[model samples]
Target chain A: MAEVRVENVSRSFGAHKALDDVSIAFPDGGFYALLGPSGSGKTTLLRQIAGFDFPDSGRIVIDGKGVERVPVEKRRIGMVFQNYALFPNMSVTDNVAFGLSVRGVSRAEIAGEVQRALDLVQLGGLGERRPHQLSGGQRQRVALARAIVIRPQVLLLDEPLSALDKALRVDMQVELKRIQREVGITTIFVTHDQEEALTMSDRIGILREGRLVQEGSPEEIYDHPVSEFAATFLGDANILRGEATETGIRLGDGTEIATRLNSMVRMTGKVSCAVRPERITILPASAAASTTGNRLAGRVSKRIFAGDSSTYFVERDGQTIKVLVQNAGQIPFDEGQDIVLTWSPESTVLIRT
Target chain B: MTSAQAARKGIRPALPLLAPAYLWLTVAIFLPLSAMAFFSFMTDLPMAGREWSLTLKNYAAFFSTSLYLTLLWSSLRLGLEVTAWCLVIGFPAAYVLAKVLKGRAREAIFLLVILPFWSNGLVRIFSWAMVLREGGILDTALNAVLPFTVSIDLMYSYPAVIIGLVHSYVPYMVLTCYLTLQAIDDSLIEAARSLGASRRQVLRRLILPLAMPGIVAGAVLIFVPVVGSFMEPRILGGRTGTFYGTVIEDQFVAVFNWPLGAALSFILLAVVLLILAASAPILRRAQQ
Candidate 1:
């Protein structure tokens, strides 16, 4: 296992810049996720790390060595493609043994290593079946086993679980995390699903328009997004645009809202504050006189009753403020009912407009 | 209705759609085959001017004659050699066309590969004869480039026959192999490379196995025809061309023994069927 670093990488295809000055340090034994929407260059950076594509101008350092010019076979990096890419001609045993056999390992050694890898993926007795005979999730396990059996310096996964159905995807997510921990290989996975990044990685780097937008722990980026794009993209955040004040911002209706003091964005003439939906509490309008912190009076425009929690859309001065409240057997507020939305200042993040 | 009856009803509509093609095939292929099989059992043609009797002498002659067996063995060998050459020359061309060349260039080259079919097969054989003869284009070109005098006469030989057959049929190999190679996902190749497989290893382990269907399909197409091809051998091989097909032609045309010819043709059909049956399992597995 080794720390992989991308320093000032930029790549372009024709006139389109796929990755621009992107840099991230994936630490040793840490699970890192490159999260982004389509066309955000997340897959580009993964390919660069895997040595499938060279960066136009940058250095990719793996295990304290510069390997920008190294070919994929020489890189000793195992990659699992989005489609799993299991060789259809080979049985499960041969598929897992491919890396070792190609490297000229002995037959006895390959047999043992392939068995061990298959067992690691919890497919111990399924060595004789071909790829078409196996289920989709089983194919994924075979692909993973095939990659890791070579004992690569780092494991690269390009949206490997994206092909699975929802239930299987969640199961594989936990299963994948277990395998990564068991093997302790420094791994980087690319995903567009923010929840997968949040649930799986120790660190997340969100990309936008071929640029790195934010890189930090999932909790850190989630709680304190630096820009409006990051705020809305990573999770649901009610954004309020207004004039900047000493603490937070004043809404266009002249209502003052307090924000966290340690926000990354500097207070300026114009700024926006991102308040998470779950952080706000919805109460009757008559009860607003007793509460403290940032508060707004609005009618509940809509209420969505989920199993564990409920989301209330409150319209205040022509702007809808979303408030999430846990379902605790209390009578839910109806639409068109007057309500007050209140949250602590620490829950609000001041984002650069 | 019962499910079986329902299934029969479901097929009823498609029968109208399928009739014309099946009828054409029965008339064009099966009727002649049936007639030949019947004639192979007779001693002579059943015409008003001749007395004919049902006999197994036609088939008996095929097994009793060592010359016929030798010719059949030689024909099978010819088929094997031509198919091997086509595979050697065609598979790489297919790989380059499918994977290396891009959109417009790939299409243009593919057109060139199949362009041999636009002209007549006889024209193609004659053209190869012109190229391979003693003082033809090949000989002249080699003599012009050489530092010493070389005879360079390859016409009227086994090699010339193999060359003509391979040239006439290589496009089938390339077309079949190209389709299967193109259908292979690019990521599978990338995945193999990432697993530390070199280019040669990828070809041997992944590509060749995955393309078995196309290779088998191409082999069947080229081999079946090349084994039965009397024209190219007659045009190119001269005296060396007397294989099973030429002997069969002699029985019908030169020797005027239609019953023996029918028996020989049926034997050839049986041999071809046996080969196809042997490869059917491999082709089916490859497709899966």
Candidate 2:
């Protein structure tokens, strides 16, 4: 519904800076996720946007209007807390209608709108029940319905699906995306779960140590992480730190694993390349001496089978590289056996660090 | 014993473990209440030499006595006034203690609020006389500070009774409300504000409704005791403190009317029960 832009925001608690000169522009009607580890200032950024906490020196603009002077009550934002803080004293209907009721909307309109919101959440006909009567997933839906009922320009969700169990969380994630799509509200969600951020958001911003480390589409960031921290944090990446050469970086053992150098990296100094486990294929060393294209020889130290796919830990030059192989009819690699690992140049991400 | 057999034989140790407490409560509470109810129906104490009978005369006497009714009304009004004042003063104090104060300061301040309850209640009431009576600490302190000398005689008055009662009961309100208010998630308030509920609206719709159980518990704890309080009014209110409780005290001690006292106490019990029953639904919802 509206674009939210946070510009040059810096906030501190005592000596510790929670957010440091962080800037990100959330485009209109796009579901953007702020992803970071704990104490990385992702939640702090979300709270600043919601007007719950003000930045020490920054500008937060919502719908092209600067909101530094406006309080949360007058800012017309909607928020879903991690706990789904529905008004326990109110029925589900009343909880959904709370924003409208506070704004002095008519009773008839509030009832209709509340019902519509509940229906949008697929929780219609349960408005008379109190919050305690609802299950955890139901409470989550109610929290979402309550937030969007007032048609807020920006919806803020702070780890909303973190409380639900795995199955329920997966189900609600789809439900949440559907509701956000239907409403077309500019939603900014704060979550530390990498899979949830990657699967849910249109754009993902990764925060580290109070700074925005990377902001891009999930695929872009995953496939072309600019820093070692981003590559390792966003997903599991086997980082190969070595000296840069004309084509790629050479490991300490003189194994030149050639990879495409992204624009972020200059081939003049030491660099690192992150190769995902699933991107590499494992082959017996006897069958791999003649092959080229980023190959490594190692003994399989550990093999983890998970029915459909298997993860093989390959030890090469005192370092372990993980290779994931889909389970078809091929013979599984045994632990302690010599294996050859190979991945294409495009799958390897050249890290700036 | 095997675990299965031990489970099947659940009452082996549990009953004996709980017997002492149940016995004490029965002797200390239930038996006396039953005796009081019985006494309310008797014409006189059942002395072996005297002939006594179960009668409705005491109940009838309460219905007929205009003086008793007026005193009961006075006591009810006193309870209401004291409860209101305690809430007005206590809720904000509780809010500050629970929400505003932090770390070691909150614990220290909370202890300070409850410090008076550590001392004897009667001593505390009598101490107020020194502050409220003419030529007392208040009079001396005020006269010393003011340019014009002034009399500070607040003793032997209705407000004096309210002050003492409020002073005695305010901690109950604060303690209960602090627990509930502190338990409230901070996110709920933030969520309400983000949804465009102003500070006042947040307090009215979210905070107050969520804290109702504590408020109700405090009101009940204060109102019940204050309604039956004879010592506080006697010490602080002086002659103007002839409440229903004081009148009942007169029946037992001054008038030597045991049956009438029992009846009055029973009527007050009924009133307390009625009040609790009236608010049970609201309190139940709040607890949920």
Candidate 3:
């Protein structure tokens, strides 16, 4: 419903800085995820946008209005905590109706709104049950329903699906995306799970050590990570360190691996190229290599079969390269067998560090 | 079988482990209560060279006498007043201890709250006497600050008795309420605030409802004792302290009528039990 922008926000607790000069804009009606490891300030940034805590220096604007100093209750932001935090003393109906009742909505209107909100979350007839009576997934729905029923300007979720089991978490992720789309509210989701962020958000901001390391579409960041940390943290990547050359980088073993040298990197000194595991094709060493792509000949030291795909750990010049091959009725490669790995120049991202 | 039934059966193996506590209760509590019940139905104490017989005269006397009933009513009123004051003063103190203060500061303040228990109850009551009596510490402090001279004679008054009882029992309220308040998750408060509930609304709608068990517990702890309290009223109330407890004490020590004293004590116990039974539903609901 509204664009929320955090600009140059810095917050400190005693000697430790929780958030350091972090800024990210959540566009109107867009689902943005703040992803980071623990203590990386993703939750801190979310709290700042929610107005739970004020930044030492910065401005938080909602709908073009300065609101960094406004208290949480008046900011019109709804948050679902990691634990769901449903009021155990009240039934599900009262829990969803809490926001409307607090704002002094009419009694009849509150009832209608609560029912609609519950139905939106696909929990239509669970109004009479207490929080303790509901299952883990049901409580999550009630928590979501409670937040969005108030029609907040922005919805903030802090690791909302972390409490559910894996299967339930996957189901709720889809359900959550559907509800957000249906409501058409700008939502800021904070999570440490990289897969959840990549699968759920329109734009993902990766944070580390109180700084925004990368922010872009999930595919953009995945395809072109600026640094080794971004490449490795966002997904699995095999980094090959080498000396930069005109066309590519020459590895320590005197083998030149081709790279496109995108604008993010310059070929003048030592560099690293990140190749995704799934992007590399594994071929028997006896077969002829492809005419125009980076290739590495190595022996398969280990192979992991995970139902539908296999991950082969290839050893070349004392460095391990991983290649993911889908299980498609081809005879699996055995350990200690020689293989040639090939990936296109565009799939290999060159990084300066 | 249902889990509850399974659980009940599971407790059977531990029944032997519970014997010592049950034995201690039987010897220390139940036996004395049974003796008292027997004495309340007697015509007189069967002492050396004394006559005794079973009779309903003790029960008849209690029902027929207006003075006894009136004093019982007044004692119940006193208990209610003392409990109300303790709650009004202790709940906020508990909230501060549980939610506001943290770390060593919280521990230090909590020590201060329960510090009264470290001293003897009589000593604490007598200390209040020193503060409330005319020309006492409070009087001197007030007279030193006020522009006009006024007598600060609060001793031997109803408010003096109420104040003394509340002081002696407020820690019970604070300790009980603090335990429950501290168990509330901080995120619940944040969730309520994020939902546009003001501070006052959060307290009323969330905190109060969640802490009801503690309030009910503290009220029981304070009310039951204050109803039968003779020391606080006798020490603080002076001539105005002629409630059911003092009268029962008089029958035993001054009148030398054991039968009447025992009868009076039984009636008081019955009244307390009736009140507790009446509020059992509310207490059960609060726990849920």
- Top-DockQ structure, candidate number: 3
lDDT tens digits by residue: candidate 2, B1-288: 898998998886788889999999999999998998998899998878977899999988878869888888999999999999999999999999999999999989999899989999989999999899988999999999999989969999888899999999999999999999999988889888988988999999999988988998899999999999999899899999889999889888999888989999999999889988987987786655
Better of 1 and 3 by DockQ: 3
True contacts kept of 2: 0.92
Q: Cα deviation of B108 in candidate 1 (Å)?
A: 1.6
Worst 10 residues of 1 chain A by lDDT: A262-271
Candidate 3 wrong stretches, greater than 4 Å: A265-267, B1-11, B147-150, B282-288
- Give the worst 10-residue stretch by lDDT in candidate 3 chain B: B279-288
- Native-to-model Cα distance after best TM-score fit, residue B8 in candidate 1, in Å: 8.3
Q: What is candidate 1's TM-score for chain B alone?
A: 0.94
Off by over 4 Å in 1: A263-265, A288-290, B1-14, B17-19, B63-65, B139-153, B277-288
Best-to-worst order by lDDT is 1, 3, 2
Number of the predicted model whose TM-score against the real structure is largest: 3
If scored against the real structure, what TM-score would every candidate get? 0.93, 0.94, 0.96
- Each model's lDDT: 0.93, 0.91, 0.92
Per-residue C-alpha lDDT of model 1 across residues B118-229, encoded as one tens digit per residue:
9998999999899999999998999899998787789999999999899999999999999899989999999999999999999988898888889988999999988888
Instruction: Give me the runs in candidate 2 sitting further than 4 Å from their true place.
Output: A288-290, B1-14, B37-57, B278-288
Pairs with backbone N, CA or C atoms under 3 Å apart (clashes), candidate 3: none
